[model samples]
Target: MQIDPSATSHPALPFEYDVCVDRLPDIVTRETESAVRSGAIPTFVSTDGKTWVSYVDLFINMGQGRRLRDPASAFFVSPEAMRRISYSSDQIDAAGPDLSERNKVTLAGAKRIAATLAQLRKDLPPWPYDLRVPWSEDFDFPLAAFIKAGQLDAYPSGRCWWVRSVEATKLLPIGESFDDPASPWFVGPHGRADHAEVVRLSAAHRRHWPEIYGPALTPRVR
Candidate 1:
């Protein structure tokens, strides 16, 4: 994406960074713009359409373990998720990365993300933040498994939000199917109620599912 440095806003804190959308796919652009128009916060976009970033990326990055394999996945955070996380629209700021520097994915980016997590540890202190390694396991949700299942309905803002009925937690073997109601991983009636409660109560829970599961989750063909 062509980044226009002059039009960006820079926030003062560590998790803060600019969001430029000039390089995003057309679907992403449309989804993001619709979210903004429907009362969601308007994240900073470069006047030159070269840079863009969103609060969801920053929020996920704040956690202990996070990575972006598919940058397009950032859009999974819906407007409701943003409100649930208590992120303020006014908190967004735009800033420019060193444009002259040729952008290349390097170990340095990974290290920087790790370092940022380390600093967050010292600055925030980990009382409220509990760190645990995630596991890889598959789970099923027949109600919403079909690609078109939930796409027909619009969110409160008249935008369609992809619905996923079942998901695997961070702990389980990779590629394992848990769609059978009898699977231990299935969210059962007598399972640890607290765990299920946390999942239901938090948007971050869904956003970071892959991290919670070390491997990709596969849908069951029930």
Candidate 2:
């Protein structure tokens, strides 16, 4: 759908804010595309409309607060708007199969936005596979499963998938899952397999982290 040009100057909200409560999905859908297309940035406005980063940011990044100004502006959705998309903020990592309500809103919005943007700009990067990143034969199924679970967050940006790396202790754990390369669960920055895939396979189950990726306890070890 085409963005309504009339919405350009949001009347009521602050200059920093983009879309408001009443028109979140459509306006956000448009803005997300602009970010990927023309590079427009966004910020989540607070419930009071006085604050820049909404309470939603706290729910993401393990309450450490999101990086609002740099890297890229996160969708500045208000709590009221957040309700339109999801319910909670609990996460498996910085991002994962089940993202919080705010995150779900952001991601779903990105998929629609990016898909549309890709069509308009041929120069925009295509899917990751076309970049010659060397995928394992079995990559498709689990990756599809992950996408189906709504966990993958690498959006269609100009370069590689924009995997938003978060604090080491949060989503996408910082350390190696297994020290032994012979183990099936080994994970690191540069593994024999795809790094993101290895991380996803070994760490997607955040709630069960202690039980997973432990080679000695792994079934593969036996």
**How high is each candidate's TM-score?**
0.25, 0.17
Pairs of residues at least 3 apart in sequence or in different chains that clash in candidate 2: 43-76, 44-76, 44-77, 93-171, 94-171, 96-151, 97-151
Candidate 2 has a TM-score of: 0.17
Residues 86-188 of candidate 1: C-alpha lDDT, one tens digit per residue: 2222211113354232222212222344443334333331222222211223633332233235432212111212222222233334654333355543432
Candidate 1 global CA lDDT score: 0.31
**lDDT of candidate 2 over 1-222, digit per residue (tens):** 112224433223332233343433454445344443442333544555532222221222111122222234243344444322221332223245655554344434434333322232333222232111123445532223333355754444332232323211133234433334443323322211122322332232222333222455332200
Question: Which residue segments of model 2 deviate by more than 4 Å?
Answer: 1-98, 123-222
Provide the clashing-pair count of each candidate structure: 17, 7
Candidate 1 — worst ten consecutive residues by lDDT sum?
154-163
- How much does each candidate deviate from the true structure in C-alpha RMSD? 18.0, 18.8
> Residue 217 CA error for candidate 1 (Å)?
34
Task: Rate residue 123 of model 1 by lDDT.
Answer: 34
